[model samples]
Target: MTAAEDVTVVPANEASWDDVAAVFGTTDYPGRCQCQRFKVAGWIWRDSTQEQRTAMLRAQTACGEPGAATSGLVAYVGGEPAGWVAVEPRIAYPKLRGTRVPWTGRSEDKDDDGVWAVTCFAVRKGFRGRGLTYPLARATIGFARERGARALEAYPMITQPGKEITWGELHVGARQVFADAGFEEVGHPTPRRVLMRIELSIVD
Candidate 1:
């Protein structure tokens, strides 16, 4: 287990919107994105205001609503919301369907509901670089398996020394992050982006 595995991670529906907002802060990429990059389609996302995006995220997360279905997972450290990961059925992300990232070299069914994707991750501003994403990524394995996902996939940045990628571009994660979480690199869609996957059915 990674050092940050001790952090407690929970379903977004069980967390409060305030805590979720805290993780996204009020500035930086995560703040503006609200993790909706892959959720909404092109024109809808481009035309929607920040407030509309925020509302869409809140509804997707269903935060603070007990028994509601949530779209992601939230992490807490010392009882403070510290990180988040968007792991849901592949079909849930409308934008992902039309993107070249996942379709560049494979014949994957864009509508496969059994395949889940770890599309985004955000660590609280003050809580970043603390390995919070390690646990967040690991948690996705079980989160997806329990939800009946046959496999979990992520398109992550392959970090190289002296080569810097903006955090906004690395939201999916780094190559090692998913590797540590037991994902194997299956393809390199681009120089920085690599396709990683864990087969839940075989792992059992």
Candidate 2:
């Protein structure tokens, strides 16, 4: 397991595109989706080509530009790109507006830009099972708070102890990951999914 001290998190824009791609790899859902699942409208696989999705991710991340806006955070373990977490204003994800998961029992405005969401997490093949998501999840709190978000939310899957979940199903992260990061459960939209959130008090 990589020590927490060996993990470093940075805004996606500050990391190079190569590092981002390294985390996404070329096979798996993360590779094919490229974190554009929520960014695109309609069924992602039907609406966008692989190349188009990749391009969209690149533009959203704005990799290699420190001053540009970024939509996520990248984690480096021992100086190698190991993971990524997609976080940005909830308004940035158009698909969420039409999705039922985030709005089942909640009566909040769907267009709230002050609310941010952690939509996906991807850990590089060689770096899995090392608790990288903990730091990545922890990082989103300050990342969103510092960016002026009123609150940060995540829709994570509920995991069972003996049940084996595919990486594709857990890409949004397991519920405990966000809970450990100080997120409180706000809603349970499905039998297997929970909406967790942390309210942030922005300081001027």
Candidate 3:
């Protein structure tokens, strides 16, 4: 296990595809989800082989390929990929269409490409509760903003006392992570989930 102090968060494009796979392949929580939940739609993902999913993730995130910029972010805990966060223009995720979390109580255009969304998170088993998500979320803001995202949104869950949610359930992320990154709650589409947003101005 890598020490927390040695952890570094880098763009997914900078790391090898294998490093990102290490995080997803560490366990078979659901057999190669590969953080492809939002990237693919419905049963099509179900039929895709692990290798297929892996290749899609690699292409989508552009891992280890400097020239390609359309991908997510990966967190390396002392040279080992320990976590991942999916941050991309809202339009990139077809599965989000008509989803209650992104639409309820909001009157925004569904096809806006300038609006980025933080769709999911993956923290490797041993790196689960070592304060990884927050940093990943923070780094995501910079990643999107630099790419000219006018606003970024995330659907994160609210945590409460006496309520213990498993990592699988909290894969979207925790509300506090967004709050700390200066995102304001735009709406609570679900009782446990909040749609948060942060506006960015290129002129600033």
Candidate 4:
């Protein structure tokens, strides 16, 4: 069992791009999608090539440049890259603005830069089921709050006990993970997905 103390979370810009790639290995949907599902303006599978998506991820992460803007956080277990979570201003995800899930029951400004969103989470193969995302999710609260985000939100899929969910389906994260991180459910747009958020007090 991987203890909570074994994990260290850092902004993507502070990590190496190679470490980030290692977390999103080659065989899984994470590798192909490269966390670009909601990043692209159109349908990801049809509009972007794998190479294009990979390039986009690398550029967005700005890995190795601490002074640059980053789109997410990377987690290391015992100094090995083990997980990643994409959190950025909601407007940064053009495709998500068009999706009905976030807009279903709430009247939110689609272009609110103060409102940040946690879009995806990818855990390395060997690190799966170790509860690494809990800390990663918790880290985003401070990461976003310090950066001026008035709120941090996540659209997570609901998971039930004994009902196995594929990694692909849980990439956005399981509802409980965010809930454990102090996020409150603000919207239930679909039967299987709930929008979770934590209203943060922006730091000066």
Candidate 5:
């Protein structure tokens, strides 16, 4: 078995589609989602078929093609797939543009593609509580900056002890998780959700 301390993250495109699929698994929210929640929006998202979401994720990841631009990152522990996180330009998430959770109190241009976002995460069942999200979140900073991102954002739940947030709801991440990665809570869009961000450009 791969030790948690050996976790190594790499761009999803650098990994094979099968490895990515292994992280996503075969049941529950992560399996059904394939991390496409933010890619499709509104009725389209509700109406889209599972097969469609899977195909979209496959193409989006561009797995097996090392040179293709990937939409997320994957983590491996001792050569075994362990986790996945979707990090890409904010503009790449179509559902986020029309959403209110990320912009409730902030005055910012919604069209900036240079602004990146961590939209989703999936940790393999056996690897839960191994602190995989920390490195995944930290990696987005350099990944986006290297790709010309001016800012990086995440919508994380404000988890409290004794609170039982469903795995599906917490898939975006938790407040403390991103905070540990150096993100600041800029907007409290809801009682349970917070909009956290890190500014690379210092413009907003």
Candidate 6:
């Protein structure tokens, strides 16, 4: 297990834009993604330029400006930004439209913004495998629960022992982290990805 003290997870709204940027780094991979995969879809996704995507991230994550909050939480290790987790109401992510997992085995009002969702996670180069995801996941619950979220959901990958999966595959996060955070598996649209959810009232 990684030392819990090594990192600090704060609501994105509370973190400075520069700090969040550091966690995401100045690289093309993260720069291009702009944490907007779920915010855009199909033709628009293909046509949208990086600049447009970046702006979308700025608007959604609420970076830089005071009172502006990212849709996720930023993680810092000993004061250095180390990671991020993108979470918000399901409606905030446009790409989720018509997604199979969220619709399978469950009937939910798709328009309900009270239902928050955990979509993505990013741990900086050296911060991986330090149990950062779990704390981030735990912190998300606190963040959402305090904000009056009725429920929170996550889509995570199921990794098997000795099976090496690429970082991209685990970007949504691992199942163990959600389980540790008290989210129960409610649906499985894909063998590798399971839909996990926890009602805020059940936390206690």
Query: Quick one: best lDDT, which candidate?
Result: 2
Candidate 4 runs further than 4 Å off = 202-204
Task: Tell me the alpha-carbon RMSD of every candidate.
Answer: 1.8, 1.6, 2.5, 1.6, 2.5, 1.8
User: For model 2, how big is the CA root-mean-square deviation?
Assistant: 1.6
Clashes per prediction? 0, 0, 1, 0, 0, 2
lDDT of each: 0.89, 0.93, 0.82, 0.92, 0.87, 0.82
| Model 2 misplacement above 4 A | 202-204
The residue pairs found clashing in candidate 2 are none
Q: If the candidates were sorted by their lDDT against the true structure, best first, what order would they fall in? A: 2, 4, 1, 5, 6, 3
The reply for model 3, stretches above 4 Å from the true place, is 1-5, 43-47, 202-204
Question: Residue 22 in candidate 1 has what lDDT?
Answer: 93
Please give, for residues 60-122, the per-residue lDDT of candidate 4 as tens digits. Answer: 999999999999999999999999999999999988877899999888999899999999999
What value does the lDDT take at residue 200 in candidate 1? 99
List, residue by residue over 44-100, the lDDT tens digit for candidate 3: 566666777777887887876777876688898877778888899998888788578
Clashes of 1: 0
> Which residue runs of candidate 1 sit more than 4 Å off their true CA positions?
1-6, 43-46
For TM-score, candidate 3 versus 4, the one ahead is: 4
Candidate 5 on 29-105: residue-level lDDT in tens? 99887787877655546466788888999999999888888999999888899899999988888888788997897
Candidate number with the higher lDDT (3 or 4): 4
State candidate 2's TM-score. 0.96
List of clashing residue pairs for candidate 5:
none
TM-score of 1: 0.94
